[model samples]
Structure formats: structure tokens, C-alpha cells
Target: MSLLISFSHLISRTFLLDFLYLFSVQIAQQVKLNKEFFSLDPATGLDGKIYGLPLYGGTDALFYNPKLFEEAGLDPNKPPKTWAELQEYAKKLTKPEKGQYGMGIYGKTVHAVRIMHYMSNAGANGDILRLNRKKNNSWDILVNSPASLKAWQYLRKFVDDKSIPPNTVELTYPDLISLFAQGKVAMLTTGPWGIATIKAANPNIEFRVALHPTPDGKPPKLRTAPLITVISKRSKNPNEAYTFLKYLTIQIGAEMAGKGYGVLTQTAANTPQVKNNPMMKVFADQQKYAYFSAQELLLAEWLKCKDQAWGPAWEGMLMGSVSPKEAVNQAAKRIKEILGDKGNLIYPVK
Candidate 1:
């Protein structure tokens, strides 16, 4: 019986039922895992049944170039702890004449995820579309909430101040990574995976990682995406598959982390491979305040909303064609239309 390991993003309700089997309760109890990963399981509809084991995935954090910080006369050891400080530091780091920008802003089509990080830092609890677990897991369309408005407006300041690239709206994640590696951008908000990418891009670059700055300089609630491993229902040897899964996740989890993959378990994070690495350490520490976004509940709807609704609105605001409030309102209206009768919608008060 061959065990199938899938890393695709097509894990849906039908995919879960037709392809995967729930892990036995005894198998679950044998190993300790982070509780947050459980919420990311696609088998959420199955009450109290474990279907997947989270292996590794990225978590958001602030990555900065220490050389740029020193050149700007800012302390290389002290990264921004609040939004205000970030802005101040960005201004100092901006050297427009040299073709350098202070920060890299994601204004591309899939920018919603990065925008949600700002919303989370501004006290939206790390989600613009929140799942009200108290209301039977109903959806709350908080895209136009006060916190969200503040977040959008804050991003606009970067554009207005000319602290980001001129082609920000066209820049994708990889573009930003390339810019950061080339030392064209002083600061970036990315994940642990960036450590390896940056090094591979420029082996001599000097960089450091820090927690995402919040409004009040407190610890922030941010987003994470964990890769999970599930058993194929068609497998003839479930026990054999379980053994391999355990060995992959438990025994060699730290080795994976050392290779710049994500650290899924505390034991792996505590290992010298992760703990001693300055960049990876910051991301591992950030996991304590990280969460999987509520949008995961209805991923298809959320992706559609990004394509047709919020994505456009967000870009329009950054492009100066729309006000932040107007953009948020427009996004909320369209999202409500897209998600009609799917989950409970909480519109902003007029």
C-alpha cells in the first residue's frame, strides 16, 4: 500500500471526504502538536475527529536590512515596534536619489493577505473577515470596521509619502523579495522562508528579522498558513502511513526547520537549528500570537471576493482613485453580495 503525500491547495470538503481518512484517536494522542494547526484542518465539519497533521508552513514577520538601518543612523538592533516608529524609520531609510525605497508594499492582485496583517496589527484581531465562533461560526464582514479603516489609511501614507516603490501596485511577492535581496528596499514584511531566499539571492546581504509592529507596540496577532499531511482513504495500509507521517513530523521536524522549512512543533523550534538562527527564531517566536485566518472556512468565496471585490478596492485606494473609507465600503458591499446566505454577515454601522 503506497502512502500518498499531497502539498496542493485543493483541500476542499469533497477532497477531504473522497480522499482522506480521519487519524485514529490513539495515533493523535501519541504525539504532541500545536493546537492552532487543528483549526486549519479541512475536516472541520467532522466533529472532534482529527484528519490531518500539520507539518510546516510560513508565519508573517518583519524582515529588515541591518546595513540600511545603520546607513540611516537608526539602531541596527532596534527594529520598529509600532506603526509610528515604522513610518519614522521608513522615512529615514528612504534614499530616493539612490533608487532605494524605505519599504516594500504589496499592491498586487493577492495583496489582501498582507493588508490583513496590517488590519491585525491595528486591533482587528488578525482577521478582516472574522469567524464569530460564538455565533455558531458565522462570518463577520469587518472589512469596513474601524480597525480595518485605520489599517488601509496607514498603508496609504506609505504611498503618499513616496516611501515605497513607484510600481508598488504591480509588484508581486517575488518582486518584493528580489527588491529586498538587492538592498533596494530597507524593510519588508514576509515569512521565515525569506531567510533562505534572501541569502540565495545575495549571500553577502546583512539582514535581521523582527515581530510585526503593532499600533501600540504590543505583541500582535498575525496570520499563518500551515501545511498539513493527511492519509489517503484509498491506502491499504493505514498503520504504515501513520508511522511514516509520525517519523516525518516528529522525529525529523527539527532537521526540516534547519533547512529553512517551517517549524511545526515546539520541540523543533527549541532546537539549536531554529533557536540559534536569528531570522528563524523571530518567526518561531511569532507563532505564539499567530492564527489561521477565518477566511479559510470559505476559501473559494474569499478568493472570488479578492478577485472581484476587495482586491480592486484596495488597489484603487492605494492608487489615489478612491478614499480608504469608500474602498472599504465598496469591498464590503460586493463581498456581502458574493457571500450571500453562506455565512452570517455583519455590516459596518452606517
Candidate 2:
């Protein structure tokens, strides 16, 4: 988060990213103290910066009960391949008759829009906001592309088709979680964090995690959210933080079999040392396909793009307020506004 954009910091002259980078450079030297940090070669990037090194990699999986699959006639061992299968299984598993739902999903929640990037990656035709990757160093919006639109329509199915409860719009993070704990929703598109909640809720729910389902016949290609761990500018122990960050991401992550944490940072997906845990293994598998947000650098523009891009467009689709074509156009226009004229490549970085 850039303090420069913060409402309170609005009056402050310094931009947050700029300020953070000043400290980041110092920590880079500290991190160099540790020779073992070699997974992501900072030198690979033109700036010699491994921006994602501290953040590691992330994943979204279905954490369901092993026991529930058997009871629901689902092969917990072999999770559903497509969204249809997931919906079918969830419908069967959700027995409001038995005081349980098929699946729990947070609908219309404010932050809900933020997480929809998964849909785009799962083959959604468009996103509310996009970072025009073809362009040079500076970033700009490219939201509402065909890819973003396709993803939006596909993800909305679970909600529009009533796969989730109609009143799902009433559900927020807390509400959805509570229902899931009660076993109301049998399956959900979730990350590893849901495991503890499931266990805490019914101890016996028995759940396993799987890749986010694909849209109809589309192939499954999940997108991991960004969570970079930059060196705290004010930290007294910047070196320790940097060391820990590097060690945790490189050595420890590679060593774990199924790291309970959100993601892995090791670049080599199939390295022997990365074969430590099943959880880590699942994450490591994505090193090849994983993509962080394109709008990641341009925070303000991306957020604006998201609102005009996917959010408005998707709402219309869900409410039948607009056709996908119109939705896609709206998103694109917003992206163009943010992109200005620099929507193309530039001279390569020296």
C-alpha cells in the first residue's frame, strides 16, 4: 500500500512506493549477507530486483472434508475437473434439508470485486482492470479486454444460476464463513486459509483443497493474488526481516512438503528440495503458469480500472442489466482512459 495515496498521507509530499524503495535498496544489501537466497535471481530482471521474492507465490484451492466427499458421493480423492462438476457436487452435498448448504460464497461484498481476478485467470475473457503488458516500464490500465469479459461471465454463473443461495448477496466474509462452518455450503472456491476454519467449525467436516474450477469446457488456469513483503522503511531490524524473508521463501519454502502458508517463492517448481510437502508441492506446480497482476505497479490506475472495468460490467451481466458486449466495451473504455496514449511497448530497459 502506498502511503502517498493514503487519504491521511495525501498532504504528505512523498509517494509511498518511492519512499519504500529507498529502504528496499538498503535491505537488498542486508539480504545479500545471506548467500543461500538464490531461488529468484534478482539479476534476471532488468532492475535486478526480485519484486515477488518477499511475497512468495500464492494459490486458491478447494479445501473440503475428506469425509464429506464420501458422504456426498464425491471422490474427495479425485476432485471435480470443471465448474459444472463442482456445482453438481455442491448441490448434492448441500442439504439445507440436513441443515447444510451446497457451498458458501461471499456475494456482492465490497472486497468481492478484488478477488475476481481468479475468474479472469480461469479463462474469463476480461478483467475490470488490466495492466497492458505490451507497454514499456510505466503502467496503464487495460481493463475490459475480451479476456476479462469472458472471465467475468464465467465466474458469475455460480451466483446467477443460483448454485449459491439467492440471498448470497447478503453474505459477506463473516457470513459466508459461518455458513460454511455449519456445512451449509459443501464446496467453495477458497485458498488454504479455509482449512483451519473448517476444522474449527466441525472438526469432523473433513476437507481437501483443489484448484479453482474452470468455466464450462475451459481449462483450469488459476491466478495467484499479490502479497509482496517489502522491507519496512522504518524497521530497526531490516536485515533480519530481509534475511528471514529470503530464507523463508527460498530455503524453508523449498524444504516444506505442504507448506501451510499461502504460497511458495521457489522458482523451480520441480526441484527435489521443493518436494517437501503436499501443500508446497501444489503451489510449486504453478511456478510455470502463475501470473501476478499486471496492474500491480499502478495501484491507483488499476483500482479505477477495476471499478469501471470488471465491477460495473459484471454487475450488469449478473443483473441482466447489459449484454456481455456492452460490458466489455465499458471496461475497455475505462482502461483506455487510464492508459492514455502509452498503451504500447517502449524501448527496452538498459
User: What residue runs in model 2 are displaced by over 4 Å at the alpha carbon?
Assistant: 1-17, 26-52, 55-57, 65-68, 94-101, 111-130, 133-143, 215-220, 231-245, 251-259, 266-281, 307-309, 323-328, 334-350
Please identify model 1 stretches exceeding 4 Å from their true place: 1-8, 11-50, 124-126, 132-138, 233-236
Clashes (N, CA, C under 3 Å) per candidate? 0, 37
lDDT of 2 by residue, 1-350 (tens): 11112221211333534544554434454445223332334432324455434344455666555566788787778877666777677666765556666666664554433345444554434344444334454443333445655655655666555656657655676677666666666666655555555667678655556665665534445555444455556668755666676665556555442434444443434455346546445555543354544344434344555545556665565566776567666656655665577442121111
Candidate topping lDDT: 1
Query: Cα RMSD to native, each candidate?
Result: 3.3, 6.9
TM-score of each: 0.86, 0.68
Measured with C-alpha atoms, the lDDT of residue 133 in candidate 1 is 54
Error of 2 at 83 (Å): 3.4
